[model samples]
Target chain A: MPQQKLESVEDLAAKAKALRRDVLLQVYKAQSGHPGGSLSWIDIGVALYYHEMAVFPEDPANPARDRFVLSKGHACPAQYALLADQGFFPKAWLETFRQYPTKLQGHAENHYTPGVEVTTGSLGQGLPQAVGIALGLKVQKAAQRVYCVIGDGESQEGVIWEAAMAAPHHKLDNLCVFHDLNGLQIDGDVKKVMNINPVPDKWRAFGWAVKEIDGHDFTQILEALAWARTVKGQPAMICARTVKGKGVSFMENQAGWHGVAPKTEDYEKALAELAD
Target chain B: MAGMETAGVGGKVGVVMDSLRDAYGDTLVELGNEGANIVVFDADLAGSTRTSKFAKAFPDRFFNMGAAEQGMVAAAAGASTTGVVPFVSTFAMFATGRAYEFVRQAVGVGHQNVKIVATHAGLTVGEDGGTHQCLEDLALMRMIPGMTVLSPADALETKQAIRAAYAHKGPVYVRLTRDKFPRIHAEDYRFQIGKAVMMRPGTDVLLVGCGLGTSICLAAADLLAAEGIEATVLHCPTIKLFDRETLLRLAKAHRAVVTCEEHQAHGGLGGVVAELLSEAHPMPLRRVGVQDQFGQSGKPEKLLEAYGVTPQAVAAAAKAAL
Candidate 1:
């Protein structure tokens, strides 16, 4: 019942910081995950899972629960951290992240994790799954909403547009996609590699109800989700503007950290900064 | 096809003829009547792929993914996670070629329970030309792990195979054709996955085939028998989980093996037979199919014949082996 109301911005931001710390720790242990992308999107994760979305971590597959798909699968450390906080799995699962045969892989896959709804690692796959699941839920006349997160760089794939076209055509208002508008990808800045400029306009053109927000702001994330739920006859797209490596001082705004993990000293420094 | 009659266990050979696509539609309606959680998807080719019948019958369950094969496939994979038997239909070219990575990642890697019923397979797609022919579909689908590949010869076989594929829980690729084919099985032909059916028995030459090529082998056997050749005909509808035991036994018992198919000679039925024989029983073999070449615009029967996949060609291939 407390989840129905947005938590204080200070509390949600603190939760986000802890999640960020967890993301850095897991990526540090794995030594091979996308820390930059994961860090950039943890705020949205914190907002959605902790303060928003009616989800049962114990019965993850419960038909009555809202669905969440991380289309930017490389950003799973953030999700893994948040899911741990929510008790979807033991907080101990984060300690075993990226260890072979463990539930936490380098990317989020539904088969491995109990709370994940779609197996996403390949970019541009998750939104379509969300659209399909939304369609299915709509057909069944269910009340559960579906939330999906895609990256700005992942927007380059053709399947994303295919799903963009489909969600609106089906009039799936139950679907709300958050584009983690972190300008940096594996190659560097998304604008330099290939600009996803005029992003909101494009979604609007595709017939989705588009909203622009600061992704790191829990207030805006909550507002967009709330507004999206009220919108009828179209899917909603929240273009969440964010920094690539958000929390840590050295890592923030650096594309080089997109995948490569921090060293022990660097991790200690990051943990100390968060401790401050 | 209201009361589309079915008959005995491989008893009535060549009694009726119908298109696999239409038979697929009729069978889907029958299955839809005694239904479970079966949902149909087509990439804007419902009229052509014959999934429109299912859409009409079970309007609530059918999802017409307009012209986007890649996303459609991934979405079907998504639907499967929610415990729905997803039957995704599209042209073979789009299903296997256009969305190979989507299928590979979603169905292959995700391990989703999706049945890909691709129509207009091989050279028989006619008029749509080489772009739509899709000769490499069987080869491509076979390469995927945990995928059941079935290329049924005629309407009856296609009908039964669709049901069997639905019942077997996992990913399946059933290639259907554009034109109706000569029915080699009785109306009540029950399809068993991974087991080749012995159409006819003989000792001089074993003529093995699948899809339209199975009937070609039957016709070749008739021609061979006329010349006192007495060729055994083996119909291998399931190409991936191929009947290795039956193939080994027959190859061991027979004089030589001649494989025929309406697909590429390298990776379709011919390749499967050759690979099986190469390992288990190394016997003399001759393959009757298209060489490494793409198909062209023409009539279905004419294209099959012109591409050197006729009854006479199969008979000649078997005779040459002898």
Candidate 2:
């Protein structure tokens, strides 16, 4: 049987809300995961993994399969939830988040996990690796694409721009960089700590086809990604405007949830809000 | 396998390039023909590091990562994650020193199968002087956990080393020199990662060497042989995976040992040998390498001679150790 393709924005929006709810429930159970960035990236992850990207659940290591790298690895709860939902692993394994000897480590490990394309936690480094994968795929004349999602806070790393400069120079149209412009990092708001505003312009200056979109809006993300797929001669960057801690009312735009999992009471309240 | 046989014979008859950097490019092209999985990466020194041949043969597999050594190493690590065995080439100084942190975390800690092929190591980089010549790369790379270190003696040895490195698992650093030297090893001489090659056997004194120093030690062995002073020459190529049994046997047979390398005496092959011998068998030892001082602009041979890294210096060090 053929896989059911995602058709409308409403279907994608409903899927994003369901995944966001799962993200909150998992983080609440783990009591030691990042809820904010995961919540903020729900729609984008859903659109990419469910709608836009072409992947095979049974043959995750298929040479022709598209690649996705989570450069900002702290937001792994969303990635884990999405992969689990996609049947990369058992959904029951999601209960063992951050547990000993589990394939799901605090950060993704490509060696152990099936779906993760690269193991990344260090900021600014994953983009180059993504570039390498895309370059390698191109060399093999494979039709697969590479997508790399990074944090706005992580844009401060010099290596990011170094990679960015090479992507367009090589004419890597198969590569797409998603800057999760969630405005907040560990210490405080990303703008106050170090301004990465003019984000799309920065990527544009580095030679990528730039697109800005409301991160939580499913229609905007789908359109941006579809347009990125059509672009040629250079890589594309989707500067996704997002709210840190997007789903729950109390956690929305809150910097404290950047790396913290909620308490039991906080988790229940967060789940209730996300469900509604 | 045909390329392997050619490389094996080529190194002995001097048909191969004189320098390891040159051989790196040639060998990469051969490896590319042998297998499609081998990819080459450079930090904008395609010609300097001599990987242009591979670039020409496999343009799509070749990535000139600009002047960003750190990003190159990290990306190489990432490529390795995808199951493509990537050989990242750059100057020894930049590949190890400038990108130490990234190599450490991404390759070493991540346990990626990325080969860091570095050229222009030690004083042999000549008039480019201290800035380009990396005398401390071995020390720095050997310190990293799970890093396999190889310093080949000549161009032939470099080909053998590259083949062996590909077969080996995990991260590897293959150190190459910029200057040309004599081909000492004969054809069919197999190179292994952990085992040291016993070049010449003697009982009185053991001369331990690596890289260009290995060839110098072999020459010194002939010099000492002419003088009726029996000397043993051991080519300790893989510094990280030093042969403990061979070293112990050499130490037991020869009362004193003389260590040679084109690097700082501190934390190099000498330091590694000293630490091993000091713990197991206390033997009188003398080191022949660059002292704790910077190199000056001069010819490569003059620099080696001035730094007391000559055949005569090895003979003198052997006498002194005795």
Question: Which model scores highest in TM-score?
Answer: 1
- Tens digit per residue, CA lDDT, model 1, B1-322: 1111110112244356668998888777888899667888889999998998988998888888899999999888877876778889999999999989878877887778999999989887878898889988989999999999999988878889999988988899999988667778876668899989999999899989898788778888888898999998999999999999898888888888998888898898888988888887887899888899999998676677788887788788877887
Per-residue lDDT over A40-157 for candidate 2, one digit per residue giving the tens place of the 0 to 100 score = 8878888898798877777787776789988887788889888888888888878787877678777766766778877677777688888878877776677889998988888888
TM-score of 1: 0.93
Q: Name the DockQ score for candidate 1.
A: 0.54
lDDT of 1 by residue, A1-276 (tens): 123324788888888888888998898887878889998888988888877788787778878788898999989998898788887888888878999769998877777887888778899888888887887777667888889999999999999999999888878999999999989888888889998888999999999999999998888888888899889999999999999889898999999998898899999999998883
Question: What is the TM-score of chain A, computed separately for every candidate?
Answer: 0.96, 0.96
TM-score (C-alpha) between model 2 and the true structure? 0.89
Candidate 2 wrong stretches, greater than 4 Å: A1-8, A21-33, B1-17, B81-83, B144-146, B167-169, B220-229, B278-282, B291-296, B305-321
Cα miss at A22, model 2 (Å)?
4.6
The residue pairs in collision within model 2 are none
